[model samples]
Target: MKRPIRVLVAKVGLDGHDRGAKVIATSLRDAGMEVIYTGLRQTPEMVVNTALQEDVDAIGISILSGAHMTVFPKVMELMKQKELTDVLVTGGGIIPEADIKKLQEIGVGELFPPGTAMKDIVSYIEEWVAENRNF
Candidate 1:
């Protein structure tokens, strides 16, 4: 049997606006993925740890606190530090386009800003997991 994709949707740093995160989480869930939401004010470590323990296929971090640079890299670093490279890391927020490019360059996946269709994120994850998942 094919497993439903499991995803951890997290809010990092002081970003308290979770309406977007909740929306994405619901969309991903409705798309037949298991979702765990790590609520507001989560550290990168918390997110990586949760993803590790949950054994998620991907992590969707919703960041609006202008800390995408620090938080995304930290999460990516932790994912590497803990050897969670098989887990995909992506996010949505107010990140600049240039920074988004840089993040992708460093191995963080896509960064979706507001107004991105939920289906796009879901499809992106599906394809990414299929291509990148080691097992």
Candidate 2:
């Protein structure tokens, strides 16, 4: 049997609010994907390293501290350095639409804003993994 998709959900930087991260983690787990949730106050390097060690198929970052600009790019850079290019780096929070576009331009995947449906998030990750990850 093929292994289930593995995802690492993280909260980078000083974002103390982790309710959303926890929700995403649980939802993903319920969707049959394995989720590794790194609790609050993580750095970009730490997130990437954990993703590597866990061999996750994606990294879902939950940021509400207005650090999307710095956090996403730093994670992307670290992923590049670690040759984790196949991993999807998607997330959600209070990010502006323009910033989302910019982050997408920089190779970050879809950035869902607050109130995005859980099914949508689940479907996106499922489709992304189906297309990108070689099982």
Candidate 3:
């Protein structure tokens, strides 16, 4: 049997509201991916380190702290620094459309917004990992 995709879902920075992150985690778990949630107030370095240590295929960061610009880019920069280009970085929450596009251009796989159907997020990650997990 194929092993399910392993994802490290984390809440970064001062994002205190975790209701959405928890929801995504549960949805992904139900979709058969092994999810490791790092709870709240995590730094970009910590999230990347945990992803490497856990050997997860993807990193899903849920941030509502309005720090996605800093946090997401920082995570990507550190991932490059740690030679971790293989891990997929995707996330959502209170992010404007313009920033989302910019993030995607810089290699953030995808961005989900409020009311994005959970099934779509699940499918997106599953298909992406299935194709990108060549690592």
| The candidate that achieves the highest TM-score relative to the unseen native structure | 2
Q: Report the lDDT tens digits of candidate 1 across residue range 1-100.
A: 6788999999988878999999999999999999999999999999999998999999999988888889888898889999998888998989999999
Using Cα atoms with residue i matched to residue i, what is each candidate's TM-score against the true structure?
A: 0.97, 0.99, 0.96
Off-target runs (Cα >4 Å) in candidate 3 are none
Query: Over the stretch 64-107, how does candidate 3's per-residue lDDT look in tens digits?
Result: 87899898889999999999987889998999999998888788
Which residue window of length 10 is worst by lDDT in model 1?
Answer: 126-135
**2 against 3, candidate with superior lDDT:** 2
- Computed on alpha carbons, the lDDT of every model, listed in order, comes to 0.92, 0.96, 0.91
Which 10 residues in a row give candidate 3 its minimum summed lDDT? 126-135
Model 2 ranges off by over 4 Å: none
User: Which candidate gets the maximum lDDT versus the true structure?
Assistant: 2
Give the better candidate number (1 or 3) by TM-score.
1
Count of residue pairs whose backbone atoms collide, per candidate = 0, 0, 0
- CA RMSD for every model? 0.9, 0.5, 1.0
